[model samples]
Target: MYAFEYKRPASLAEAAQLLSGDDEAKLVAGGQTFIPTLKQRLAQPSTVIDLGAIGELAGIREEAGGVTIGAMTRHGQVASNDVVRRVIPSLAGMAEVIGDPQVRNLGTLGGSIANNDPAADYPGALLALQATIRTNKREIAADDFLTGMFDTALEADEIIKEVHFKKPDVGHYEKFRNPASRYAIVGAYVTRYGGTVRVAITGAGACAHRWSAAESALGGNFAADAVAGLTVDAGDLNSDIHASADYRAHLVKVMTQRAVKACA
Candidate 1:
């Protein structure tokens, strides 16, 4: 990796200022993605703004209406949080399956969401849970936050501070992952709240996308059999060495059904 100036900011404001000052500066929360990019020479940033010293960017807050997870909160924390498990078990389950112990201990929710990897677990849960991405500039709905593969709606220098997830009536996540990498080959999250239903799929397309047909069918009837007749085309799905686009499409339905069963 090329030499780069590193700045450890003690506060969110300072981190934001440093990021705003240098266009080529990258934010380093957990460094799982950034470190790899640096090692591969895929990114040559002039500066690296480390947010580890920013205490404001860590922790989990449970409220009556919902829960707010600080951006820099690590996956291990989320996976084991008793409060998170009680309130949003699906999210806990998703977090628990995020990588091996070392990666989970180091990977932060903010980093994962910011990277916007197509196979990342957080995006599907975010979309299905109707979560909100709270950034330094504004709060964006999960549906609007993700753009495409490795892309988001965040502007330059914008840093995510927290994510808010609504309390659903019931929800569950099921992922068929690439065993070696632990990245999703195909994943599904199904959430039911009041009379509404949402089904989100990841690791299958350009990005995590909601299954409108499944949602519509399942919304009308929250049952595993509700989605049996529905199908998604493999035309735009991802095809990697781990799994074909068609295979990923098949997994999407299977995972969705499993998620529904788990939710039930």
Candidate 2:
């Protein structure tokens, strides 16, 4: 890694101040992705502000008919948290399958959502469950927070403080994971809240996105047949050596069907 100044701020206000002053500063949460990029010389920030020291950015609590998780809360914590398991079992199940134990132990919800990796699992859950991202500066809805693949609405000086997810009446996630990295080849998160049904698809497109057509069909009939009847357009999907765009679309439908079963 290139030589850099490291700042570990105790508070979010101090962290923002430290970041705003440094023209080339990057925030490091879990450092699962950024650290590798640093070693590869893909990034050369003048300063690295570690959010780990901020005590307010770590924990899980219930509020306002939903669950709020501090940004620094690790994937392992989310997977194991009793409140998460009780309130959003499907979301907890999704967290349990991310990477291996080491990555889970280090990786965090805020980091995953901020990075917005196209293949990441948390994006699928966030989008499907109607999550809200809280930053030091402002709060962004999940739809607005994740702008694109490896992109988000976060400003350079902004630090994500926590994430709020509404407890769905029923929800489930299914993924076709890459054997080596455990990244999603095609992941689907399906949710139903009262009469509303939502389907979020990831790993098949440039970013995780909601499927309105499937949601519409499922809103009326929440069944595998509802997903089966709808045709997925391959035009907007990602295609690569591992799987073609058309194949990914097929996987999306199949996984959505599986997710429905899991939700039921």
Candidate 3:
């Protein structure tokens, strides 16, 4: 890694001030992706502001008719937290399967969503559950927060505070992941709240997005057969060596079906 000044602020306000004052500073939460990028010389910042020491940014709480997860909360914590499991077990399950033990231990929810990796798991769940992303500045809807690959709507110095997720009446997540990294090649999160059904798909496109067609169909009939004829367009999906765009589109449908089945 290139030489850089490291600062671990004890509070959110301090971190925000530090970030706003430096034009060439970067934030590090769990360092799962940032550390590797630094090692490969893909990113060389003048200062690396570590968010780990900020105690207020990590925890799980029951509130607002659902659950609120602090930004710096680790994946393993989310996976094993009793409140998360009780309020949104499918979310906990999704957290449980992200990467391997090392990645799970080191990756933070804020960092993952901020990085906005297309294959990341949280986006799908957030979109499907219609979660809210609360930052130091303001609150952003999950749909508005995730823009594209490796992108978000956060400002230059904005810091995510917590994510508030509505407890769905029924929810499930299904994914076809890369065996090595365990990153989803195509993943689907299905959720139903009263009569409204939402389906979110990840890894197949530039970013996680709601499958409106599938959602509409499933809303009418919450079952696997509901989406039997639904087709995901392949033209805009990611086609890497791991899988073709067409294959990923196919997996979207399959995973959505499987998720719906599990919810049933």
Which is the leading candidate under lDDT? 3
Tens-place lDDT per residue, model 1, 61-90, is: 897667899999999999999889989888
After best superposition, candidate 3 residue 178: deviation in angstroms? Answer: 0.3
State the lDDT of candidate 2 residue by residue for 166-263, as single tens digits.
99999999999999989999999999999899899989999899999999999999999987778999999999988999999999999999999888
Report lDDT (Cα) of residue 12, candidate 1: 90
Clashing pairs in 3: none
Which runs of model 3 end up more than 4 angstroms from their true locations?
A: none
Which lDDT tens digits does candidate 3 get at residues 26-90? 99999999999999999999999999999989999999879999999999999999999999999
Q: For each candidate in the order shown, give its overall lDDT on alpha carbons.
A: 0.92, 0.92, 0.94
**On a 0 to 100 scale, what is the lDDT of residue 111 in model 3?**
94
Per-model TM-score on C-alpha atoms: 0.98, 0.98, 0.99
Per-residue lDDT of 221 in model 1: 93
Return whichever of 2 and 3 wins on lDDT: 3
Which candidate, 1 or 3, has the higher lDDT?
3
